[model samples]
Target: MEVFLSICLGLGLSASSGFRVFLPMLIANIAAMSGWISPAESFAWLATWPAFFALLTATIAEIGGYYVPFIDNLLDTIATPAAIIAGTLLSTSFIQIDNPVLQWGLGLILGGGTAGMVQVGTGLLRLLSSKTTAGLGNPVVSTAENVASFGLSGLAIFLPIIAMVLVVLLILWLFRKIANLRKTK
Candidate 1:
């Protein structure tokens, strides 16, 4: 059950990564440093000050990038793989599986897949927003994504089960949004 909760937290964070890749990692870093959670042995560096600062910097940059006009679109192209990689790392860190191969395999599949799917959904949403509003609506979308990343990270740490439920709901919403976007195109 403990392991299950950790995976739940990881998956929740993974979903948040789709919105902002580094914010989830920064949250995990803080959680580790504060003794709220323990990362796997290999990921112990996450509890250190250097990792915290680095993730903080990256988080700030990522958030700021999304508020930029044309750059936000370019960032989406970069965010897909970055979100997958960050999601895999975040999930693998909390998971305590003994087997190296199995741990990473599950992280890559479940965590990466969750983040990648949501990243694509968000990218599509941004594209639709840009098309409909001529890029004026992107900042609003960016703000919402920022709020989601922060909210989900908080829930993932403090309420793993609730976080998982939100992740599910968010994914379902993303699917509906994607379908609607497709209809318009």
Candidate 2:
């Protein structure tokens, strides 16, 4: 039961990472620092000050970069792989398991997969926004993604089960959106 909840928490945070990589890490570090959550034994560093400060800096940079016009699209190309790594890391940090192989494998598959899906969905939306609005609508898209990242991270920490439900719904929505986009192309 505990493992399940923790995995749900990880998945929720991973989904948030899909929107913005560092924000979810920052939020999780804050959660750990505040004693709201406990990371896996090896991930104890996640609760430290250095990790917090580094993640803070990265988060701010990531958030600001998205508000820029062409740079946001460029960032998306880099972010897809980064989000997968972050998602896997964030997911693995919560799973309190004895078997290293199973833990990491699940983290890579479920967490990375979730983040990649959401990232692709957002990337497609940004492309559409760029084309339709001539980049004017990108900032709005960036802002919404940022807000969703924060909101999902919060829910992942405080209400993981509900967060997981929302993440699943988000996945479904992404699937539909991606399929429609492909059909249009």
Candidate 3:
């Protein structure tokens, strides 16, 4: 049960990374420091003050970058892969499987995959918004993503089961919407 919860938390936080790469890391650092969550032995560095401040700075820069018009799209090109790496790291941090091979396998497959899917969805959404609104609507989308990253990170730490449910629902909704868009095209 404890292991299950850890995976759920990891995946949930990983998915949140899709929206904003550093937000989940910041959340995890705070959680680890506050005793809300415990990282694996290999990831203990994340709980340090330096890591906390570094992630805080990165989080601010990432959020601000998304608010820039054309820069947001350009950043997406970079952020997608970064999010996957961050997601995998986030998952491995909380998960405690004994086998290193199995742990990293699950982290890359589940955590990285979830973050990639969500990042793709958001990138597409941002593209659509940019097209429809001449990039004027991107800040709103950026704001929403920021809120989502923060909310999902908190939920992932404190209520992982609920966060996983939300992630599933979000994926389903994205699939349905994509299918509908395809049908129209």
Candidate 4:
């Protein structure tokens, strides 16, 4: 049950990574630091006070940076790697694994892959918003992203399966909207 829960949690965190890369990691860092969740021995580094502080600082900076008009788009360019790394870390940290290979493989496929997919989708959304809305509607998009990231992170930490379902639904909805737009064009 613990293993299943942890995997679900990892998947949830990975999905949250699609929205904002660091938000879920920051949440996990705080949770682990506060002893709400216990990570595996290999991931004990995340529990350190220094790591927590660093992640907190990074999280705040990332949030603040996203509110800047053109700067937000620039940040998205770099956020891809951040999202993937954060996804892998969050997913791999909680799972107990004796073999390094298995842990890494799962982390790459589930964590990194999920984050990358979400990040790509979000980048496209921002691009389309910027093109059609002239960046005027970016704040609304940003706000939604922030909320989704925060809410999904919390859900991932607590109830992962539901988070996964939400991620699936979100992806399908986005895909359908995009297809409809292409057809209209």
TM-score, each model? 0.94, 0.98, 0.97, 0.91
lDDT of 2 by residue, 1-185 (tens): 89989999999999999999999999999999999999999899999999999999999999999998999999999999999999999999997777989999988998999999999889988998999999999999999999999999999999999999999999998888778867998
TM-score for candidate 3? 0.97
Which consecutive 10 residues in model 2 have the weakest lDDT in total?
173-182
As for candidate 3, its clashing pairs are none
Q: Model-by-model lDDT, in order? A: 0.91, 0.94, 0.94, 0.83
Error of 2 at 27 (Å): 0.2
* lDDT digits (tens) for residues 151-174 of candidate 4: 998988777779878877877877
* Count of clashing residue pairs in every prediction: 0, 0, 0, 0
Q: For model 1, how does the per-residue alpha-carbon lDDT over 84-137 read when each residue is reduced to its tens digit?
A: 998999888887788989889889987898899889988988998999999999
Model 1 ranges off by over 4 Å = 179-185
Which residue window of length 10 is worst by lDDT in model 1? Answer: 173-182
lDDT of 3 at 117: 85
The TM-score, computed over Cα atoms with residue i paired to residue i, of candidate 2 is 0.98
Pairs that collide, model 2: none
